[model samples]
Target: MKKKTRTRLLVITACLLLFGLFLRGNPDEIIPFGLVIGGAALIIYGVKNRRQGGQPTVLPIMTKEKEAHYLESGMTEKEIEFFRETMNQTKKQILQLQENINQNAKLKAIDLRHDTLRASKALFKELVKDPQKLHFANHFLYTHLPNMVDLTDKFIEINGHEIKTKETYEKIEESSQIIDQMAALIAKDYQQFVADDLEDLDVELSIAKQSLKRDNSL
Candidate 1:
């Protein structure tokens, strides 16, 4: 069960138990039924969150631009739908991190990487057309992006306590470095795709020019 869901259930159960006792009823009998219902609700919530990849807060928003780009990239309707959901979830996480960065000056390092994430996201939208490139891009789109978001959120949570110990400082430093590295790797992946496309375009243009010259000679 997710920690929040479990905590909520525990609080509800405790409150129900207190209420039963206050009424001078059989606490054991009253609490058992409440516990069973709460347990079921917790199980349901946990399953739903698990299916959502533990991001219960993220709502999938499919933008028109995303649809147009995906269609232009030759993705089938089904693949477009799948990738849309993936992109929405990633966008939610990235937006969350961005909002946090804006609010927290201590998270300046995370803020610095925001542009890299955005650039990589744009490249990813373009590169998804090629299955071979998409295979590698998945690491940035699915894994590393989410990891950076989670790490930033956790770091912010840790900082909220205002406990400035050496251990906490070290953790903050480590997280900053890791987030920076992930940003660099994502940027590098996107650049590789762009470089490949540019090279191919150059070759095609050269071939076309040579063919035109040969025709003129003939």
Candidate 2:
């Protein structure tokens, strides 16, 4: 048996034994049958739990680099690893895009792109908890992120050379506008990314709490 399972069985056995002793000490005092039944039921439930290999519901999610941040966040080890990997990939793309934005000559475009990237980073954090829902964000991850980075990089290279013609400036401005719009659209998708995860988490937690209550009553 697992150590946790053994511990639970020991606790249940102890409780049941104490109850039996209490009844024995007061055999003629008309003890409540309900107490005896509850104790027996708890013992049976513990045995069943052991047989089924039930585990506890408390899961903590935190990366080692976070330095005790989210100490109380409940996530399993797999969930933590998934969240960390997703965040790393996202930060890489954001850094590349930010570099391009910083190199842009237009101050307004640079500021807008910077703000959009920051918002996207925040959204990434909010949406990472639900790995299942991550598939819904594939377009942003696989297409928009790379596309924005590529467009901005090319625009930076082209704009750094000269400002001789109005048409060249227009092209640079257009590229900035396109990248800015894509980032905004990507940010909008963040709401969709987290929606399903939040709903599922609510349902899971409700079921877990109800199951705990039922077990306790038994």
lDDT of 1 by residue, 1-218 (tens): 77687668766776766676659866666667666766876777678668777655444566787678767777788886666566566667667766766666656654465566466557656654553356656777777767877887887787777668998888878877787777777677677657877899999999999999999999
Separately for all candidates shown, the number of backbone clashes (residues 3 or more apart, or on different chains) is: 0, 1
Q: How would you encode candidate 2's per-residue C-alpha lDDT over 4-89 as one tens digit per residue?
A: 68667766766676578676886553345546655666787778777677754332454564524333365555665665676677
Query: After superposition on all CA atoms, how large is the RMSD of candidate 2?
Result: 27.6
Q: Against the true structure, what is each candidate's TM-score? A: 0.58, 0.46
CA lDDT, candidate 1, residue 63: 76
Runs of candidate 1 exceeding 4 Å displacement: 1-74, 105-115, 127-133, 201-218
Q: What's model 1's TM-score?
A: 0.58
lDDT of model 1 at position 182: 71
Candidate 1: clashing pairs of residues = none
Best by TM-score: 1
